[model samples]
Target: MIVRCLEIIHPDGDYPVAEFDGIRVGGVYPVLEMVTDDDHCYIRVLGPDSPDPGLEWDPVSFETVDTRIPPGWTLAIAGGRTRLADARWQRPGFWTDYYRGDPQARADYDHVKSELLAAAPPREN
Candidate 1:
């Protein structure tokens, strides 16, 4: 699906983002991936300064921090794939490296996220 959104700064919409299943996405935060099935959408979010350990998304709200990374939080809303790709590419650093598809980025992010998830509290289900 095409990632379209009215920017608050500039209401006119822009590029489409990609999802976890490999579609496009767009948002304030760089969306590494997204999952939209049924009426719900789940996105793998990354932060600017931190690893952005995963979150337990209940399809509506996020209550669990799956990764060891603290100060982690989920933005419940999402947009089309790669919607922010162009804008993101223009400015890069930290977790944004992964969003740009840097080969080592996935490994580096996975390593950190995995360790955090392991150390994190167990999930309810």
Candidate 2:
């Protein structure tokens, strides 16, 4: 499975770092290959089942990381069907890459992580 890096510029200047299974891609919010050159930074409302199961079709906005490759910067991007826009999973805190484990998967669904978690059914005491 190919994992794409999502370039997100947090409005508060806190960028979403690129991570796969909790492994940093050398830098915070690094450019990923799965992101096509044609892709531009904008907010898109994803549909239901777009990200994962149990996630309702609630509109989630995101900033696409449009990176211009530097003259001497070389990076490896794992290829997969995943995209920045598709990053919005059906459930908050749900990761598309299940193989990576819970922490990593949840890390991928950063956009609505808080929302999803909050939306989740309260734990039983």
Candidate 3:
């Protein structure tokens, strides 16, 4: 299944509508649009077992893992794969662009998911 993305409005606002495969699967963001705001928020996509027929807003859960790039590699947005190459990291801000850097592949949803998964500080084990 293709992992789609949607914009997450904040300050308690409605999430933009999302569409995939011409199917109006329930979502809280738009398929393609400029996202504004810098609240360290998230852009979520529903899973297969999403609560359909109901839009009950609820906090999502995730897993965590100790991970980070080698300070030079970049993330593959389309596939969530990382490759060692010269990459320019962008500053924290409202990111409207789907991908990072020139010749952008796609937005780094995997990276975002990773961050969310590890939102809690990692424990040395």
lDDT of 3 by residue, 40-80 (tens): 32223233233321122222211213233333334333223
Please give the lDDT score at residue 25 for candidate 2.
Answer: 33
**Across residues 12-113, which tens digit of lDDT does each residue of candidate 1 receive?**
344332332211123223333344545555645443332344321222322223322232322232333222222222233535777777766667666645
C-alpha displacement of 60 in model 1, angstroms?
A: 11
Clashing pairs in 2: 2-79, 2-80, 51-89, 52-90, 55-90, 55-91
Provide the lDDT at 125 for model 3: 14
Quality of model 2 by C-alpha lDDT:
0.32
Give per-residue CA lDDT, model 2, range 1-20, as digits (tens).
11122343334456564432
The superposed Cα distance between candidate 3 and the true structure at residue 36, in angstroms, equals 14
Q: Rate the local accuracy (lDDT) of all candidates.
A: 0.36, 0.32, 0.29
**Backbone steric clashes in candidate 3, count:** 0
Per-candidate alpha-carbon RMSD to the true structure = 13.9, 15.7, 13.2
Best by TM-score: 1
Model 1 — TM-score against the truth? 0.30
Among all windows of ten consecutive residues in candidate 2, which has the lowest summed lDDT? 53-62
Q: TM-score of the candidate numbered 2?
A: 0.19
Q: Pick the candidate with the highest lDDT.
A: 1
